[model samples]
Target chain A: MRATTIHAPRDIRLSTVPDPTITAPTDAIVRVLAACICGSDLWPYRGENPIDEGVTIGHEAVGVVEEVGAEVTSFRAGDFVIVPFDHCDNTCPHCLAGVQSACDHLGFTTSGQAELTRVNQAEGSLVKTEGTIDDALLPSLLALSDVMATGWHAAVAAGVRQGGTAVVVGDGAVGLCGVIAAHELGAERIIAMSRHADRQALAREFGATEVVAERDDAGVAAVLELTGGVGADAVLECVGTDQAIRTAFEVARPGSTVGFVGVPHGVELPVRHMFRRNIGLAGGMAPVRRYLPDLLDRVLDGRIDPGRVFDLTLPLDEVAEGYRAMDERRAIKVLLRP
Target chain B: MRATTIHAPRDIRLSTVPDPTITAPTDAIVRVLAACICGSDLWPYRGENPIDEGVTIGHEAVGVVEEVGAEVTSFRAGDFVIVPFDHCDNTCPHCLAGVQSACDHLGFTTSGQAELTRVNQAEGSLVKTEGTIDDALLPSLLALSDVMATGWHAAVAAGVRQGGTAVVVGDGAVGLCGVIAAHELGAERIIAMSRHADRQALAREFGATEVVAERDDAGVAAVLELTGGVGADAVLECVGTDQAIRTAFEVARPGSTVGFVGVPHGVELPVRHMFRRNIGLAGGMAPVRRYLPDLLDRVLDGRIDPGRVFDLTLPLDEVAEGYRAMDERRAIKVLLRP
Candidate 1:
């Protein structure tokens, strides 16, 4: 089997590895149909995160079950499914409370960008589609595995309400999906902050009522202006940079919350400022498994088209090019066909 | 008129000051019946918060309306009212959203410990008690002006629900009031963190089901063990120090929010840990005016007794001793009578 592996900074390659097999009673062997690179993956690829040489990469995918252990009762061979990035036993106390990201038996699904991947907690982590799905919907269905669900989590965490205004702080795939989530959640006005013309246009298509192309202080000013000088009702922080996090809080109203999903990097939370303004900070590593059912339904019903975030696509063999394109900002998100 | 003024740290004096008169169209002058020393007030008395010499200090009081400006429609002379610590125009956007503390025209009520106090935004900040009967209820009504309301804000912000478990950090008047708040909100179990024997007893009487006298790491371990190692469903942070804030988060379970109402000092938020654990932080200065109606009703109906926190009572001229008693931890809270 061939899979994506990371060796060092900017050193991504499609290498030949032994085929994965079900090693646990609750595990399942899956044949991946589609997978995508996340903005978080750029951390190690850009040397921002320390790397363990020759580690399996990629954690988002849609696949078909090929084999399942005796204990896996929810899925069977040939079943089409979306694999949540963080696998968990759904019966745990945290999972039951809708915080599957903090599940007691939590595990990450690595090597997902491969021909064959072994998934633990199969019965709990995999959400299956009703029947044979159309090939054109693969990208959207695959999005439910992580990005789309993460965006939904940000909106929920921010308490985006009907007729309220929401500000999305990044223009990446997850941020774009956040625009959709806010819209679906009945946000009357969705503001997307993006400096790129292409990303801004996509943001508009994804239901952003306005686009702010400014950065830092100017960006905060633009959002405040759009919200009648009161700041937004809810803010979705999709980028974890210090500047992005700072801007997100600055543009939130007195009692609004900032829901952050991006893996924080050198981010120092403004505790005093948050305290004085009565602003709150919520959201974290998204509990994608918890949002899978509702988001999958939205995708199947065509209520949201998150697949448009895939501006570039590549064959699994061109995995290095995919990583390069994303790292260099040439693609919003790159979809890979196995 | 005589008022409590700060000459310097530990230098409290009841000195003659000009009588308060209606200055704004929305202002009202009130004759103080009762005022209490707050934990936050001790910050300035203990030389922690920088002091402005000769400034009037207290901000919590229940009084009889002595006079009202021409435009004051909701209050009149001889009416008994609870003056919230912060005064605001009720029609402001933030106030309309139930966040009066962040009102566009927000103002603080000073000189509250004096014989007479001028309260701005009379129509908005004064909640008049209907035909007040007994002086015995004065302390409870005064508590509603700040500490009790602040504690209620913490419980509301932390999303306390029926059948949930709540943990309160701090054992001062505000934290003791928080135990009452959690119980009123239907929390099945309330844990109080305190080291002082007197305060622990008061907390238990106020509705704390369990008391943990441990501090720092030991406190976190005890709270974790209490909730089957999952932590509390909601945590109320009534103390503003870094250690108190840290302990509040440490005892909160995943997806639970830590509601903080203390005036934060030297506090650094655990952003990475919060992000990884999916814990949230919310609440700030209490919008007591917004809660005045319900809390006032509760007090009048004998459903709550928040005034029990005031264990020491003194004549208005003894304000200096009242400050010393609280500063020396001799009293949980001090009630000053005019």
Candidate 2:
């Protein structure tokens, strides 16, 4: 099986890896139909996230079950499914509360960008559709595996409600998906903070009622300008850096919340600041598996088109160029067909 | 009028100060019946929290209204009321959201321990009961002005649900009050984390079903041991120090919340830690004014007595001794009768 491997910073290579087999009683083998290069993957690509070295990478994919262990009764071979980022035993107390990312026996299988990947906890982790999916909609379905579900988590975690205004920080794939999520959640006003023309256009297409192309204090001023100087009712902190977190904090109205999903890096929030304003910050790794089912329904119903996040698509062998394009800001998100 | 003033760290003196008079359209002047020393006062008394020398020192009180400004409609002469810590307009968005501490026109009137104190935003900051008769209940009613309410905020912020388990991280007046609040919120089990025997006994009186004397790591371990290693459903962080905050975070179950109401000092929660566990942290300076209406009902009903927190009492002139007793740990809280 040919899979993308990260050996060093910016040293991604397409190499032959051993084919996956069901090793656990609850395991199932998935043949990747569509997989994505996530912004989080860039964390290591940029030498920021330390790795054990030469590991198969990627966590989001739409795949078909090629084989199932004897104990996996819920799924059979040839079942179309969405593979959520975390391998959670969906029966844990945390999973019961819709926080599968924190499942007591949680596992992360980082080999999604490959021809065949073995999935653990198959009964709880895999969500399958009854019929075959259209190739045109595969990119969006692939997004439901992680990015879109993550955006939905941001909106849900921020408590974005109907008729409320929301401020989205970051304009990358997840941020764009957040706009869609907020829109679906009935937020009357969705503002996207983006500096790029192309991303701004995509943000608008995905239901951003307003767009602020500013950064820092000026950017916060712009948010206040739109929110009657009180800030938004809910703020989606899609970028995990300190500056982005600060902006999220500043732009959230007093007594409102900031839902952050981006993997944090060097993020330190001054407790005093959040305390004085009665602000709430809730976000970590998104409970992607928990939200995948509902978000899939929304996508399949044609109510939202989160697949638009993939601006570039290529064959599996061109995966290196996909990384280069995203690193250089040439693509919002790249979809790979296996 | 007579008042307590802090001229330096550990230097508290009873001195003559100008009697307060109605100065704003929303103002009311009250002759204090009861004023309690707060744990937060020790911060400035110890010179840890910077303050201007000679400043009047007190923010929690219960008193009789002596006068009202021309525009003051809700309060008038002879009305008995509880004065919350923050002088809030109560008309801003945050106040409307029940967080008066974050009111747009927030003001703190630091003269509650005086014979007469002027209160701005009187209509919003004062909560009055119909008829006052028992002197025995006065101290308990005064507790509602701050400490007790702070504990209630911790319980409410942690979302203590009916039939849930709660762990209180502090056993001070606030922590003890949190036990009562959690009980009132219908928690099936309440754990009080305390080392002192007197506080533990008081915690039981206030509804703590269990007590843990361990601190730091051992305290957290004790909580897990009590909860079958799943952690409590709601953890109340009544202490502001980093160590106490850490215990609150550690004892909270995954997908549960930690409600903190202590004025934060040198506290920093690593985002990475909170993110991975799906733990939530909420609570700040308790919006005492917001909880007053309901808490007052509970107090008046004879269901709970939070005033037992004041183990010592002195006349206005002995206010200096009141601070001394609290500083020396001889008093859990002191009430000054001015």
Candidate 3:
């Protein structure tokens, strides 16, 4: 099987790797259909986060089940499915609580950027599509595997309500997707903080009512001014930096919630700052599996087109090119067809 | 009028100050009937938090209204009221959203430990008792001004469910009261973390199903073991240190919440650790004014006895002694009578 491999910093290669097999009773062999390069994947690609040498890279994928273990009762061969990044048992207490990201049998299946992949805990990690064979819809369905679900999680956790307002703190793909989620949540107004013209235009198309070109203090002041000094009712913090989180906290109205889904790095949150204003903070890794069914329904019903986040698409053998495009900000997100 | 004044670290003096008069159109002057020392107060009392020399130091109090400003429509002389630590305009947007503590008119009425205290935003900060005060109920009513309300906030914010398990971290007055709040929230099992014999007993009496006389890692381990490794459904973090916050995060079940109400001084929360399990963190200064009515009703109906927190009593002139007993841990809390 041809898969993308990372051997060192700024080192990515397309190499032939051994085909994956069902090694566990709960595992399933899947032929990769579509995969994606994530903002998080860039952390290692930039050499900021250390990556193990020769590890198959990528966690987001849409695949066709080739074989299912005896223990896998919910899926079977030839089924087109959305494969969530994190595989889980789906029967653990945490999974029962709808937090499969914290599943006791949690497994990070990062071989998705390949022609074939083996998924453990298949019953929990894979969700079947209604009916397939729509190549144009593959990118959108693949997004439901991770990024789209993550954006939806941020909007839902922020308590975005009908006719309410929401402020998104990042202008990345997730932030753009969050704008769409906010619209789906029935938010009357959506504010996107963006400095790039292209991203800002995409944000507006995704339902952002306004865009602020400023950063840091100026960004917060702009949100406050837009909110009439009371602040937005819901804040989606898609950037995990200290400044972004602080801006989210500062822009959310008293009694409002800030739902953050960014890969939090070097962030220091003081409870005192949040407590003084009755702010509620809720978010973490998105339980993409939990949101699969609803988001899939939306996709099937033509209610949303989340695939637009993938501005570029490349064949599996060119996975290196996709990563390069994303790492250089040349693409909002890249879809890889395997 | 005599008030408790902090001239320096460990230097508390009962000194004469100008009588508080109606300072704002919405202000009301209340003659102190009951006032208590708080754990947060001890920060300034011990100089951990710098205190402006000669500043009035208490935030919790219950008293009889002596006068109301021309614009004060809800309070008048002879009406006994619960003067919450923070005063706010009831008409502010934040206050209207049930977060009076975050009101634009927020005023920390710190003269509560004095003979006469002037309260601004009288309509929102003062809640009238059902009838004439019961001398024995003074301590409990006074608690509604801060500690009890704070505990209630923790329990409510944590979303404790009926028959769910709750863990109370920190054995201070607020923590003990949190046990009572868990009971009111219908939590079937309440675990109280405490090392003191008296505090543990008080915790059980207040509704704790069990007591863990442990601290730090041991305390968290006991809680996890008691919950069958799933961790508690709701955790109330009454301690504000880094260890306590970390323990609270570690002790909360995946998808569960930790409601913290302590005055955080040197705590830095790592969002990554919390994100891994979808742990929800919500808490801050108690919205005492928003809770005044319900807590007061509970107190008057004999549904709770929170005043037992104050085991020591002293005249206002001996406010210095009251501080000494609390600083030495001789008393769980202290009540000063002016």
Candidate 4:
């Protein structure tokens, strides 16, 4: 099997790796149909996050089940499935509570951007697609595994409701998907905060009613100005940067919750400010598995076109260029065909 | 008129002051029937909070409307009312959203422990009781002004639901009221964390099914054990100390919200832990006015006896003793009568 391996900063290559096999009773093997480079993957590729040399990368994909262990009941060989970023037993207390990311038997999907990957807790983690797979639906289905579900989590956590206003911070793939989620949730007003023209255009296409190109205090001022100085009813902090977190809280109305999904880095929560303003903070690493089934339905129904986020596509062997394109901001997201 | 004046730390005295008169059309003057010394009142008495000499101190009371400004329509002379700590227009964006504490025209009650106090936003801040007020209900009515309402805010913010588990951190008057709130909100199991035996008894009486006397790690461990290591479905943080905040988050189940009402002092939010665990932090200064009508009805119906928290009573002239009792923790709360 061939997999994308990371050796050092900006060093990504498609290399031959041992084929995956079901190692546990609950495990299953998946042959990747499509995967993509995530903004987070750029962390190590850009020398920002430390790397372990020669490790297979990627945690998002849609694929067909190749083989299943004895205990796997939900999926069978040749069954189309969306592989969520995290694998959970689904019956654990946390999973039952819809927080699958914190499941007791939590495990991350392994070797996702490869010809074959091992999936643990297959019965509880795999969401089988109905009927035969459609080539056009692969990107949207793959999105349900992580980005789209994550974006949906932010909207849910933020308490976005019908006729309410939603403020989305960050124009990344997840943030763009958040615009879709907020719209699907019936937000009457969706404000996308971005400085880039192309991303802003995509945000508008995803149902952003307004866009603020400013950052920092100016950004908060702009959002407030747009919302009649009352702030947004629901705020999605899709970027983990300190400024993004601060602005998310600042632009939230009193009693509103900021649903944050970004992996935080060097961010100090403004506890006093949050308290004084009666603002709330919710969300974390998204429980993607919890949202997969519903999101898959939305995708199949053609209600949302989240696949539009993939501005570039590449063959699996050209994975290095995909990383370069995303890192250099040449592509919003790069879909890889295996 | 006579008012409780604070000259410095440990200096509370009944001093003559100019009688309160309506200075604004939105103001109402009330003759104090009952006023209670709060845990927050102790902050300045213990010198934890800086104080200016000779300022009237006290923010919770139940009184009879002595006079009302021309524009005050909801409140009139001879009406008995619960004077919440903060006065709000109740028509602002924040107030309309049930966050009266952050109302656009927010104001704090003044000279509440005095013979006569002035309340701003009177029409919106005062909740009139049905018929003539009974002496017995005075204490409970006063509790709605702050402590009881605050406790209810915590429960409400924590999203306490039917048959769910609720953990309350802090066994003060507010926390005891939180136990009542959790019970009223239909939580099947209520856990009150307290080290004081008297408070524990009050907690149990107020509907705490379990009591954990541990602090710090032991406290978190005990709560985790109580919930089969799943943590509580809802957590109320009634104490503003760092440890109390930490324990509140530690005992919250994944995806559960911690409703915090304590006036935080030197507390650093655990953003990383909160994000990783998918725990949410909500609530702040209690919008007592928003909960006033509902809580007041509960008090009148005898469905809740939040006033039971006031274990000691004192005459208006003995305001210093009331403060002293509360400062030394000799009383759960001290109620003062004029």
Q: What is the DockQ for all candidates, taken in turn?
A: 0.79, 0.74, 0.83, 0.77
Per-candidate iRMSD: 0.7, 1.1, 1.0, 0.6
TM-score of 2: 0.98
Across A162-248, the per-residue lDDT of candidate 4 in tens digits comes to 999999999999999999999999999999999989999999999999999999999999999999999999999998888899999
DockQ of model 2 vs. true complex:
0.74
lDDT of 1 by residue, A1-338 (tens): 99999999999989999998988998998899999899999999999999999988999999999999999998999999999999888999999999999999888889888888888889888999988999999999988888999999899999999999999999999999999999999999999999989999999999999999999999999898888888899999999999999999999998889999999999998988888789999999899889998888888888998999999999999989999999889999999998
Residues A211-251, candidate 2: write the lDDT tens digits.
99999999999999999888899999898899999999999
The residue ranges of model 4 lying beyond 4 angstroms of the native Cα positions read none
Residue A178 lDDT, candidate 3, scale 0-100: 91
Pick by DockQ: which candidate is best? 3
Poorest lDDT segment (10 consecutive residues) of candidate 2 chain B? B277-286
TM-score of 3: 0.98
In order, what lDDT does every prediction score?
0.93, 0.89, 0.88, 0.93
**Per-model RMSD to reference:** 1.5, 1.4, 1.4, 1.7
Q: Which docking band does candidate 2 fall into?
A: medium
**Could you give candidate 3's per-residue lDDT for residues B1-338 as a string of tens digits?**
88888999999998888998877788899999988889998898877898889988788888999999998887789999989898888788888888887989988777988998889888877888656887999999998999999999999889889999999999989998999999999999999999999999999999999998887789889988999999999999997878888888888998888898988878887578787888878878888988888887888789999999988998888888888998998999999898
Native contacts matched by each model: 0.70, 0.64, 0.86, 0.72
- Model 3 achieves a DockQ score of 0.83
- Model 1 misplaced regions, further than 4 Å: none
Runs of candidate 3 exceeding 4 Å displacement: none
Better of 1 and 2 by lDDT: 1
User: lDDT tens string, model 1, B1-338?
Assistant: 99999988999999998898878898989999999889999999989999999999899988899999989987789999999999988998899988899988788879988899988898888998777549899989999999999999999999999989999999999999999999999999999999999999988988899999999999999999999999999999999999999999999999999999999989988898899889999999999999999998999899999999999999999999999999889999999998
> Per-residue lDDT of B166-265 in model 4, one digit per residue for the tens?
9999999999999999999999999999999999999999999999999999999999999999999999999998889999999999999999999998
